[model samples]
Target: MPSLGTDPHSVRQRVEAMEKVLERMFVIPGINKPVGLDVILDIIPGIGTISAAALGSYIAWEARNLGMSKWQIARMGGNIGFDMLLGLIPWIGAIPDLFFQSNTRNLRIIKRHLDKHHPHTKTIDVQPR
Candidate 1:
């Protein structure tokens, strides 16, 4: 694979962007207090859960584009599954997203996999040996 640094449209960037969206838009506000969107959109009968699941799926898709193996993709899917499944609960799931940070966890996994397999292709050397 070409160096991720040389490619501005690299999968790593896509994943990072998604992580940012999840953190800044959804997870962060949800944690500080009972945010309305996280509660309202999350509480709606069916559409809410579906919306969240779709957002999670987007993250998994980014993982797939990054050349992650099927196992890694499945793990990302599992995170979404957990988030959606638990998030359905009245108030429990929303609270967990603040702390669990599924997107952050998935990002970590993606970073680890890319760093391990494509160290030479990265722009930075933040990965620990």
Candidate 2:
């Protein structure tokens, strides 16, 4: 099995980059909310959620590598799964998917884990709002 990175900087860099791509790629006007590739890709219909879930799994996998408990990882997986399931719905799902960012939620979990377990490492600051 592969090991987690000893260097916190690399982990921070990776998680920050992914949070940007998955959650904060762009902001909505007026409300100033963040949105990312997952919502945009939903425009494609059936294949979009699948592709997005595939991309989102990377974040969960990283959480696993970082030594988060299986329950935590599973919760993260559930978040992603729920997002994908909702996204798969025809019309109603689109609006919610645009707003409910599972990736951002998962990122929060990762950050908390880092802050708790790896306190020596500076936490990555990739907030969605």
Candidate 3:
């Protein structure tokens, strides 16, 4: 087992940051809902869908590196696949992308795993005003 000072904590931080960038970077005006690169990428069609899926996969890859079970990784992959399918819906893709945040879901899975296996890596989330 490796020391908690490096890998687990840093992995958690990177994964969480990626999730925030993908799913909740800023709030959309008027709608007042958070949006991020995931939704923004969905606006670009084929390349967008591919980019979103790849970014989402990066989180899953991190989970794998954390030694998460194959089942959990599969579920994360499924979420990304479903999101990709939704992203293939032409102009309407961004609408669904706004709600179906695969990166956020994957992040939740990673958090649960970390919380249980590497509890020392946990930290209180302080949102900036």
Top model number, TM-score: 3
- lDDT (10s digit) by residue, model 3, range 1-129: 223344899899888888988999999888888899998999998999899899989999889989999999999999999999999987798998888899989998999999999999998977654
What TM-score would each prediction reach against the true structure? 0.69, 0.85, 0.91
Order of quality (TM-score):
3, 2, 1
lDDT of each: 0.65, 0.80, 0.89
Q: What range of 10 consecutive residues in model 1 has the weakest lDDT sum?
A: 27-36
Off by over 4 Å in 3: 1-6, 126-129
How many angstroms is residue 16 displaced in model 2 relative to the true structure, after the best TM-score fit? 2.1
Q: Report, for all candidates in order, the number of backbone clashes.
A: 0, 0, 0
Which model is ahead, 2 or 3, in terms of TM-score? 3
lDDT of 1 by residue, 5-123 (tens): 52424777776766666554532243453232333445665677667678767778777876789999988888878877767875556667565666767877888887788775355
Off by over 4 Å in 2: 1-6, 124-129
Better of 1 and 2 by lDDT: 2
Clashing pairs in 2: none
Positional deviation of 95 in candidate 1, in angstroms? 1.1
- For 24-86, candidate 2 gives per-residue lDDT tens digits of 788889989778888877766889888888899998888887788999999999999999998
lDDT of model 2, residue 13: 57
* Cand. 3 Cα-lDDT: 0.89
Go through the candidates in order and give the C-alpha RMSD of each one to the true structure. Answer: 5.9, 3.8, 3.6
Error of 3 at 28 (Å): 0.7
